[model samples]
Target: MIYQDTFGFAQQQDEQDELKSFRDEFLFPQHNGHKVIYLCGNSLGLQPKSAGQYIKIQLDNWENFAVEGWFMGDDPWLSYHKALLPTLSGLLGANDREITVMNSLTVNLHLLMVSFYKPTNKRFKILMEAGAFPSDQYAVESQVRFHGFNPKEAIIEVTPRAGEVTLRTADIIAQIEDNADEIALVLFSGINYYTGQLFDMESIVKAGHKAGAMVGLDLAHAAGNVPLQLHNWGADFASWCSYKYMNSGPGGISGAFVHERHFANDKLNRFAGWWGYRRDKQFLMQPGFDPELGAQGWNVSTSPVVLMAMHKASLDIFEKAGGIVPLRKKGDLLTGYLEYLINNINQKQGEEVYRIITPKDQKDRGSQLSVVCKRDARAIFDYLAQNGIIGDWREPDVIRLSPVPLYNSFTDIYHAAEGLFKALGATNA
Candidate 1:
């Protein structure tokens, strides 16, 4: 397809998109009797039209079956989560036994840490990216404190070189090798939330294991945005929230992955509850806990069926769209087009007024582009909001825009650039 600076080009792209019909499945917000250009899927995804129906099915089962819904209905409440396993596993590139949907994002992070971050005097330090999400920082700090270690001394953070917005894989691997004796764990976001940088997961996992350290990932931003091979990469554990690219709605249930290697290893310590007990003997109310064989054993309570219903609705869409590969292909083209237009604007303005902090190479980033405004950042952001362009602004000066392939169009990218140019002109005036 010949790229052109016209809405017709986006219309042509949409016409050629095999997954374009999927956009109708979402509930797009409206402003001034028009559909708002939503570029914030990196933050919260649009709700699926099927979500209401999915929830209603569960509500009906709950109202009619009442207490008996746990075991009696066609899709019993107890096994409702089982229906989602195949789809979730496919998305993570993991075995069914290694993946499960449960808890919120931060809660799952702590639970996975409990089993994986076993620190001792000789190798007690945890290495992580320098600017991890605040919640992750808090969780790791509390986990360190729980073991009676000072976070300042026990947490080792890897940062980018001066004037660089993203971390280099070589630097990360080198740090692991240098601290091989002191580091007990390596936990990083599969994709950095602010910079949209996709970390080298396979190499990092290999390096950590070679150094005798366990590795885990907080995939909150990476989950549906990029293709992952958690099982093949031999990652020790991982966790992710579903509300962003997965379109599971706000505060939807999250998921976790525990490598099958740990399934039979009884020595792997974890915080367990009744739900984690063996299913056949759970009702026996045994004196001791014999955990379930795999990732399901990580569950602490009954699965939330209502939230799972919404998640299942989104996964159904993913299945119909032919999984992540095709979507990622379209994502690359869409985001690349956005980058092209933005750089063109910088040239026209005669100075670099806005800079994309995300890496230029598609291999190093996901769908998001973090634009750093040189001046009048807030005013430019406010103008975009008033003009019906919906992207998110991080603290200080970054505005994140993600062109999700499932719903966003190339025209969305074009209009965003046009709106930004107008906003910049207004600020100067």
Candidate 2:
């Protein structure tokens, strides 16, 4: 493929992009009368223009109907979440019965663990990546403690070998096989929040099952960024936040998935609430709890219509853009182009000044590239921000740049690279 350093090449690519029109649907941040080069969609996505309209309809229903809105309204509040499943299911690669939108990300993680992380005397360990997000670590630790097991004894963490920044698939599979006898659950992120490495979900799920353990994924960074097949992979459970790639607003409602095979397993325990009760008998307000079948059975409270409205607006965009496959194809090219530019800049410098922590294999990563600078990383990051290039900086020294397929254009990538090149020279101390 021919590569060009000029913005004209990026503009040409944008013209050829099948999903180019999506850029207009979002509210891009502005700086100095120019749209900021927004490469932070992996942290928080741009707001969809349609989100306002969707929320307005709900606001109107609340104004006109008041309490009656629950039972008698266009798109009744009681089942508002139902309309979201068809679109969400497509993103998750799950059956409609296997997925539901409710609760926040960490909350759903705990709830899913309650049902799937059943510990026995022989098999009582929980396995995870060593450098998992602190929230996940805390959740796993608490879950183990709740079951009267010390986290030190019951939690097994796998780390990358020395001189390696990313985990090898073969090593991960081997660890699962070695610990199969003692592990009750294998939980990992589909994409690491910091490294932006996309795990082999299907292979990991299969490996966990072979060892007689349930497999689950925290997809906060993976959902909507990559194609998934949760049902086909027979994954035990998965959970994700919608604020990032899903493009719902901050602290938006989260989603969960449970394999259909587990739907009929009455023995699986859960922390129940009224929302999980059968809809037909819900208004009856009976004493006994008859849970709804499938993933809805996991819900603990009534759906939040306002949040669902914003989510529905974003989902509509996903539907209009076709699906994850086409978006991922574009993502590969966009991210690869960014990598190319970064590497070119590094070559121009005497030594390797910048390093991309994300995997080189297209299948092993999503849109985000975690760049680790060898010198003055923070100063360089701040310089990029001041120049109207918006990417996020993690602690110590990592700048995460995500070129989202929905709103980000090839031109954005080109501009971001140019800003980085300028910053490198200007900010050197």
Candidate 3:
């Protein structure tokens, strides 16, 4: 698996890519009348070409059927969400009954915490990785405060050892065991948004369960970017946003997964809403709140048909490409090639110009590589953007680039590295 720096090598790989045609499925951002090489799928994915058509179908349904669209349409709004479950079930590695489309990721996180983050006099602390997404940090802090506990006391952050950018699995497990008696919940992101490090969910879940705590995962970055096994991993609950890797529109619909084991746990608490009421008795207008059997029990309000249409447009493409397995294969090669090219740049410069902080092992990361600029960090980022290369920039020093397998080509990776090479010289001047 030797990689060459020549653009021809990238072109040859593109020629052999089974998923190359997927690049045509998306609409890219233009710079000077030419499409920019989009490598920011880790933040927001490119829109699918068919997204407009999908929305049009729903709009036409609204026009023709009006109120009757709920019951009379070809694809009834009543059951439109059901079509999404099969693909999502496969993506999240859960049964269709265990997954449901619902509120945004943070909203669902709070809802799930209501049920899973129960604190007691004996065990009341929550353990999580340090530097999770700010929304998750805020959510956990607020939830802890709402429960009448000081966040500083109730929340435990597992930070890396000195001088280490990424966490080691051993440290994570030891921290869980050390606080075993006091930890009520162990929640972590499936992949850290900054470093792009994929946590070992299976080991984490087993450790938490053995220590008498509920384990949950926020899969916002991990959902479509990496293969997950929420059910098999035995996670109590999980939530993810679809806009990033799923290419559903900006702020698109989010999804949740509740293990089947929790289905009949009547002792669990929820912020009840009518949409979560049993479908069979929903229209009966009952006074009591009886929730649906599985994850649907978490739904809070009416389904937005338009958002579902956008989500379906992208998911249908995933189905056509045979799901995340094939896409992830190409993603590895694209990212690997990018890493190789970046290393070569550092070698030629005789100094660390772009220092990659993400884990080097393919198994430890996904499509993203977070590089810290040793010099001219912000200038380097602006240079790439001005040149029409779309890698994301984090505060202070890091630039995050994600070569999405579905829409990003090997040429995109090559051109991105080429931009980095040119940027080094420009900044030096």
Candidate 4:
């Protein structure tokens, strides 16, 4: 698709968009009495207009049924999360039994590590991408320490070659082979948070397993942003937060995936709780932790009905929008248009004013473009914010602009580019 750097072209594309109607399902924040151009879905998704009604339904059930709402409501609180599994299973490309909506991301990561990250005196190291999200870095470090290994010695980060912004799949596979003798686990994010580079998870899983290690993924950016096949890829476990691309609201409930191949493996350990106890005998309050049949076994506490309701509201939209396949189709075009416009700005300026660090190929990225401003980065970011073009800024110099497919429009991307161009003159940098 040819892209033009004019507002008219953007309006024209918006007119032709098959998913254009989805933009109305969300409630955007206002700036000076108009809707702000929201390009920060990489950080936080806009609220779904139907979220309130979903929550209110559960609220009404609570009010009317009192404590009995656990079993009496339209969606019984006890089995409420089950309703979410079908859509989630489709999104993650796994069996419904392999998925469970549970705690937040990092917490689930730590819990999964307990079962997958079993290190020994000789094979006690974890191989992961360098510059992983801070929460993941901290969790791996603490887990290493808890197992009596110094983090400095137990952690192996695969860094890019000098002057490179992304990892080559060959380098990643070679690293796994090089460290095979000692590596106990291969942990990675589906998409790097900082550079917006989508990792080749299928290749990573194969390499890790061949190297005699378990594989896990942190899909916070990738779950709703890209396609996944955890079961088919043979990933041992994975987890993701719902607040960002999944758009379940701030601190929303998270989901975990455990391949069915591991379900009968008794050697694996879990930090068990009654919520995960055998469902048939849960009401009996029996002793000895007998876990539920599948991924639900990972649940450590009762489901948070309110948060799940918010999650359901958003998942329902994904279903209506025909799942991630269609969303991804539009996302590629929207992101490509933004990259094209930003490139035009640099070409017109006769210098690289904004260097996009995200991969140029659509196959290697989702909706985000991480741009490094040549000068006055903070000032330029503030200018965009002041102009009601809301993107997010990373530390140091990068600005992340994500044109989410569910709610963002082509016009939004056009005006955001306009703001980036105007910021240069306004900041005088």
Instruction: Give the residue spans of candidate 3 off by over 4 A.
Output: none
lDDT of 2 by residue, 1-429 (tens): 577877899999999999999999999888999989999988898999999999999999999999889877879898888899998899999989999999999999999999999999889999998888899999999999999999999999889999998898888899999999999999999999889999998999999999999999999999999999999999999999999999999998998999989888999999999999987888899997788888999999989999999999999999999989899999989999999999988988967788999999999999999999888899999999999999999989999999999999999999999988998889864
Alpha carbon lDDT of each predicted model: 0.92, 0.93, 0.94, 0.95
List TM-scores for all candidates, in order. 0.99, 0.98, 0.99, 0.99
- Give the Å shift of residue 285 in candidate 4: 1.2
lDDT of 4 at 68: 97
Question: At residue 228, what lDDT does model 2 achieve?
Answer: 93
Residue 375 deviation, candidate 2, in Å? 0.6
- Model 2 TM-score is 0.98
On lDDT, the candidate that comes out on top is 4
Q: Output the lDDT of residue 74, model 4.
A: 76
Per-residue alpha-carbon lDDT of candidate 3 for residues 74-169, written as tens digits (9 for 90 to 100): 899988999999999989999998998987999999999999999998899999999999999999999999999999999999999999989999
**Residue 424 displacement in candidate 1 (angstroms):** 1.0
Residues 77-124, candidate 1: write the lDDT tens digits. Answer: 888888898888888999999988899999999999999999998999
Q: 2 or 4: which has the higher lDDT?
A: 4
> What would the per-residue lDDT of candidate 4 be over residues 1-429, giving only the tens digit for each residue?
999988899999999999999999999999999999999998899999999999999999999998999999679999999899999999999999999999999999999999999998999999999999999999999999999999999999999999998999999999999999999999999999999999999999999999999999999999999999999999999999999998999999999999999998889989999899888999898778899989999889989999999999999999999999999999999999999999999999999999999999899999999999989999999999999999999989999999999999899999999999999999994
Q: Which pairs of residues collide in model 3?
A: none
